[model samples]
Target: MSLLVDTANRDTLHTLLLKLTADTKPLWGKMTPQQMIEHLIENVQYTNGTLIPICRRSPEEALEAKQRGLNPDVQIPKNLFLGDLPAEYAYLNLPASVTRLMADLELFDRYFKTNAMAIHGGFGPMDYNEWIIWHSKHFTHHFRQFGLIEGDI
Candidate 1:
């Protein structure tokens, strides 16, 4: 996968974020504009010192999943298998989806610029390249879900 920690990837993410909005309904699944913003924030928060309880996978399951990949698989339960939404985020009063998305994009850009390669858990630290690869894959997944084509501007 092309690394996303570089200038090009950052620009692409920024552009893609601009392309998303509250009115932009997904082709599948359900999430309001605010919900989507919060969802994306959680992706970075996992590495930004937030404490998410391990799903208590068996040693084998964990290892197998790791071998397949980390961030992508790690995020499955959050998106595909959600728990209760936090009270704080469950109620987002975004005046407009476009405005909210722009704010979220800024927040993501700021966080990523500073600590995109941070490593949490016991896996140790990752380099920018690894971070970008993981992040780009994630962004792409959500972007596609919203019916935004891969190369569409």
Candidate 2:
């Protein structure tokens, strides 16, 4: 199922996140629930144009990455370490982290409508639709990590 982050699916995505709790454990990967929530928030911020990366892909590389992103068979890369969490979120509890992540998702949803594009760290520049696809894949990837979505791992 396509899980784009548009008005239609925002509530559904939020509901999915509500299923997670502080005690939730991953079926794969080493991130705790709080850390996972923090990670997701950071990614959303990237799409919201609040967080910019130092490195970027060339035009040719971006084209290739975009093509790969469009491929249904291409699984999201596993165990990809984006970077360290900010100091403020270092000691955040799962509940608080989830709350913050949900807020960020809401902000991102609103920002995406008027924003022209976003620069993905690895994938490079992406239009609104591309960002939707990327965010969906990213959220699903993490959901799978926590066993929140069955048959995804």
Candidate 3:
């Protein structure tokens, strides 16, 4: 499976990053901007070793998640807030969603630098390269949903 890497993916992610505001809404999804920010934070946490979901609730669950028959399309998590907060995010204590978004992005950059390879399953254990690609692609996908253009960083 290909992960989104390359200049275009980075540029696109950067472009969309600039367009986000406290009021920015998903053009076709359920998350409020704050909720979306929280969702992304969770994703980063999972990428780092700090958070691990029960990817193997049973032997069957592991097998099902790992089955090659499954489509490669990235899954947009549902009821993302249903889970517990990552401690880092919960400790931030910020009321402004936009501020929290910026904080999350900063945390992501730091984490990406040191731990992109520390994988948790989207499909399975991904190396740093795979994680980076997935991160860029997912960010671009969301930004596009908001009708933003991918552009130079």
Candidate 4:
């Protein structure tokens, strides 16, 4: 099944996350495990409208991003640079970051049904359902980075 942040998928996502450790290395890209966790947390905050994106997309760009998101065959773009890690997350340890990620996931699950809108840095504006799909795709993309989800990307 696709990884939605609802009851059926939450435990599965958490289980995948639990398999990660401080020494986990990426099959591609350069982010450390802790940094990845922080990145995900920050992105979740963005989905929930608690954080603003670095840039906003024009109407044409937003429509294009939405179409890309809806296309199941499309892989997330590779090596997309998202700037420096936030200072607050710079010194976080692996376990703490994992804990924070899990907590943030729960918070996201709770907030997702509120029908709020958020500006995705690359995807522009997304409502609740669009954000759910985007988050699922985003999480799956990163999980594959660490080889947590095999035979998929």
- Candidate 4, 123: how far from true, in Å? 2.2
Per-residue alpha-carbon lDDT of candidate 3 for residues 1-153, written as tens digits (9 for 90 to 100): 333323234445444556666576667666554555566666766765557644434555544554432334644343334455344444243245445444555555566677544545535555565555566556545554555643222
Better of 2 and 4 by lDDT: 4
| Per-residue lDDT of model 1, residues 1-153, tens digit only | 332223235555556566666687866666755666566666655544443424356566655554455454333222464565455553345445434444544554565567654553333454455545555565666666676544321
lDDT of each: 0.52, 0.72, 0.51, 0.73
Tell me the alpha-carbon RMSD of every candidate: 5.8, 2.8, 6.4, 2.9
Q: Residue 36: error of model 3 in Å?
A: 1.5
Better of 1 and 2 by TM-score: 2
Give per-residue CA lDDT, model 2, range 30-108, as digits (tens).
7877778888888888877578753277888878988897665677767777666455555357777777777776777
TM-score for all models, in order of appearance: 0.57, 0.83, 0.55, 0.82
Candidate 4, residues 1-153, lDDT tens digits: the string is 355333227778778888888899999888878888888888887665566675467879878978887566787766777676555554358778777777766776676667576677766777767776777777878888888886455
Q: What C-alpha lDDT, on a 0 to 100 scale, does residue 21 get in candidate 4? A: 88
After best superposition, candidate 4 residue 77: deviation in angstroms? Answer: 3.4
Best by the lDDT measure: 4
In each prediction, how many residue pairs overlap at the backbone (N, C-alpha, C within less than 3 A)?
A: 0, 0, 0, 0
